[model samples]
Target: MADVYDTTYGQADYFGSEASPLLARYADWIPAEARVLDIGAGQGRNSLPLARRGCRVTALEPSGVGRAAIKAQAAEAGLDLDIVGENFMSYEPRGVFDVILCFGLVQILRYQECASLVTRLHQWLRSGGTLFLTAWHVGDPSFARLTREWERLGIRSFRSPDGSQYRLFLEDGEILKLFFRWQTIHHCEGLGPEHRHGDGPPERHGEIEVVLTRP
Candidate 1:
């Protein structure tokens, strides 16, 4: 299947060339040599930075365009990254990781797929490993527009008119319940920094951010 991000990332500087602010904010918490997995690693923004910090980063991007950009940048920077061009749902993890990043990822899955992916994350993370996650919630401004104008799959889940995109927003405190057993290092729910994708207008997302450690 043709991935949507292949088109989006093909655009000049789709997401720009910066690591996520949330990653920088929590950088001190990660071990310098930790094994890391960056899911939906669009344009390698977060992956490149982590690799530069001496973390062993595996960038999993389904978009061929995005993967090429990552490869190009990694080469220019002399950074060694394991770039995987496969959908997360089909990509089988080989070994446990010390840190896993899910920035701007979970919102793309269906409700059940989100839960299933959490279970997979639990299995992929080593004991005492860390998880950094950011996802949109129902309070996001776009959620109202999506639910009202798009094809509703379920509560807070919608498909775009042309059937090219899917989004599932979290309810307040909903994602927290899934990780009750983990030790929470940080957790917050609210609008995140303004950002844009492709040629879209400046936008904001009501998001949930969490940093947790496994037992």
Candidate 2:
């Protein structure tokens, strides 16, 4: 995965050059000088902007090349960010945070893995902290094929262009079940245009975006 991300598609291009729309929309919810954790923080899309806004940002990424890109970008911008090159599922948090961003990552995990991670995330958040989650869903046009493949092979994944298997889609109800303990601030499910990460053509997909706060 690291090699694939590094060579085929840079994290920056996968997420684009700007902060995600979800991050930009909920910027006000993150307090200035708050401690923030960005799980699967590919190429510092949210990390860089949040750090610039006076938040203490810690970006956790599994890819070395991605982490290096994040560090380089931070240095170039003269921003101080804690870049941890580790998978979010195995990486332990040193302390609770004021905010946690989990964009473009949750759907990558198996059902049980995502459930376990969300449980940990709830515990990792400080009181009144928020969690921003975005994931691919079953409404996607490619989902039917992926589901058929999974059922036939007993594996929930689709083949990537690199010949590697990638995670399949999720349902909106399933996503809600994982974070049921938190107070939802916003929740929406809809279709979105697919933007090619590298050389592939665009393929449309369904997505769910949610913001939940710990009481």
Q: Per-residue lDDT of 88-173 in model 1, one digit per residue for the tens?
A: 78889889999999988888888778878898898999999999999888898898788679999987888889988889998898
**Using lDDT as the measure, which candidate wins?**
1
Which residue runs of candidate 2 sit more than 4 Å off their true CA positions? 1-3, 9-12, 150-163
True-structure lDDT of candidate 1: 0.89
Q: Where does the lowest 10-residue lDDT sum fall in candidate 2?
A: 150-159
- TM-score of model number 1: 0.95
Could you tell me the TM-score of candidate 2? 0.88
Which residue pairs show backbone clashes in model 2?
none
Q: Clash pairs of candidate 1? A: none
Q: Write the per-residue lDDT of candidate 2 for residues 69-152, one digit (tens) a residue.
A: 889989998999999977776888889999999988866665567767778887899888999989887787777776655432
Model 2 lDDT at residue 24: 94
Task: Give the 10-residue window scoring lowest on summed lDDT in candidate 1.
Answer: 12-21
Hey, what RMSD does candidate 2 come out at?
A: 2.6
